[model samples]
Target: MTGSLISPRVDYASDPARSRGRFQIEPESRTRTPFQRDRDRIIHASAFRRLKMKTQVFVAHEGDHFRTRLTHSLEVAQIARSVARTLGLDEDLAEALALAHDLGHPPFGHAGEDQLDECMEAFGGFDHNAQTLRVVTRLEQRYPTFDGLNLTFETLEGLIKHNGPVLKNGKRMQDLPQAFLDFEHLEQLDLDTYAGPEAQVAALSDDIAYNNHDIDDGLSAGLFTIEDIKDVPLVGRIFHQVQKDYPLLDRQRVISEAVRRLIGVWIEDLTAETSRRAKRLNPKSVEDVRNLNEPLVAFSEKLDAEQKELRRFLMERMYRHYKVNRKRSQAKRILKELFGLFLSEPDTLPPPWNETAQQMTKDARARVVCDYIAGMTDNYAIDEHRRLFNLDAMI
Candidate 1:
């Protein structure tokens, strides 16, 4: 490949030089490809920095050892770059997508997202993917000419469509998120087809990273024991093997070894399956990869089934554990109260946001409030809730 450190670039890999270009044209970087520049921009974004304070399955205040969105994104980027390089795809684009994927996530993880969606339901429900697009295309305001980061079309397309085609058949299954609809007028993304191979790699990398980390977090939180997960599919087998090989190892070391081995197995399966798919499909270019009926990157069927079982275990023992649910409930309340307050009393918002909300319609005002709440870090949200709700607290 053109930028590959190990292997030659595949014919179907996305080429930064052939990128569709940014919405706002600018001088190209002399030191980096367009995709590399995109990665740099994402790394420098304010939203990306806030990810450090955004928790995944656990609240940030709960424990320092738990995985935050920032760590998760970094882990995903590492896995993505590894997969992209192994498959002769553009590692920079995969890394960029992985880094930017969670930039739109609100404080408190899924609980906050769910509350925000309910708060914004009448004004066009919130979708994290759409919120992510908005963050890059219109929310960030560091640039002199544009409000958001002027990312490449390839990065934007992957951000919007990484999970799959946005459209079902020839039409949207439902209305596009308002943010997505707003951006579509500026540039038409081919939403009916799959994203290019780098994006596909980044998407799967996210799955691999989160699954393994959640197991680690769940165990650390004491929501479940090693014995509890000893019967799960792929994960259980790995844990058993680790125990057999090092019978006297400590619990933490066993967990760490098992997670490490599981991640390696997932990466191997994904790369091999993707290579097999590419050989059978014989795509000539990135466009050919996108136009195919299915994704070019995937785990094997056996692995996929096993992965689902692992997810089910996490869902029951970890995600739905009483401790996690307690934090989630508190998170939802904070977001809900904040949204209600901001929407009803726009003048209470900070200076610029207050000024902006004054001129918008009610629906528009709701969106503005949504944007404000969505940008808060977990600790900030909690502190803001206390400041606003407790009369005894200093303003």
Candidate 2:
């Protein structure tokens, strides 16, 4: 883990000791803060390690250099901690949020998620954010008395609503995801208000990490050339500046330098914007941050606009590139096929999954299939598909 970049604490930072304590209360760790322990628990979770083989933009076997979910989470955590430190928020809380944010994503990035959602359409639909909450709160089964990791309530709050409140006016704006509704009966997260400042920072930090890293990945994949993005927003300007500053620089070095600088630009803008909001709000505590109508952490309006334009360019150029589209189609088919086979003939599922399926209602069994598939890594899903469908494939 990267060392904290800044160390000035402020009144609004989430205090670890004073945190809303764990779901199943246990003795506190003598050596760690609550938030620090939250971070450690997340890092040590089984799902956290599963991230290694899960796709970010490219499949795990595609190349040695591409980012996997594990690497991406680490990058997001690094960026979040840096921003949190600069803003005098709880670095540990922000880092934990960043790391835990993507735990719900299935094997093949958005393609896998899209397919899973389609398969579960009649079964309350699949939502990664909700699945992440489920993974931590209901599925992990790490403790003797609890089903999940038994995380602190503060961590749970951020995990559930880091994007923003699930509620609007007095009720949820849309049907709440099943996992969230399940947990709601156990503990109520104020779904109408924003998360604390640390979660807010972690959310924006994700934007920074993916946007910049995608540029690098796209370049490496030959999905688009550096020149192709040279006319995009801030990204274009950075690329041109790098080329001018290092005329003889190698291709890889140029992309790396530009991506690094872009991350710095984003972090600078975010810190400035958040500081401006902090001054205006003068929030006295973490609760004050949540109760406020607007988020305390955010990018500046100008940067937000630039990022939108850049996203448009990437959508057309990299995300929709023919090669990636082909894989998306294949990934969707693989996940869809797996879901069908498992849901229709639950006995085919190995051991405990098959045993558990026997007792569930149709919809409940479908969800069990959904969870099983959603937890698979890219290669595991592919191999499972082959085993189920390919007569010549090894068992």
lDDT of 2 by residue, 260-331 (tens): 999999999999998998899899999999999889998899999999998998899888889899889999
Q: What's the lDDT of the predicted structure labeled candidate 1?
A: 0.92
Model 2 vs truth, CA RMSD: 2.2
TM-score of each: 0.97, 0.97
Q: Note the Cα lDDT for every prediction shown.
A: 0.92, 0.89
| Displacement of the residue 87 alpha carbon in candidate 1, Å | 0.3
- What TM-score does prediction 1 earn? 0.97
In the range 1-395, model 1's lDDT, one tens digit per residue, is: 46634668999999998998988889999999999999999999999999999998888988899999999999999999999999999999999999999998999999999999999889999988999999998899998887889999899999999688898666664567776887853337888889999999999999999999999989988999999998999888899999999999999999999999999999999999999999999999999999999998999999999999999999999889998899999999999999999998999889899999988899999999999999999999999999999998748
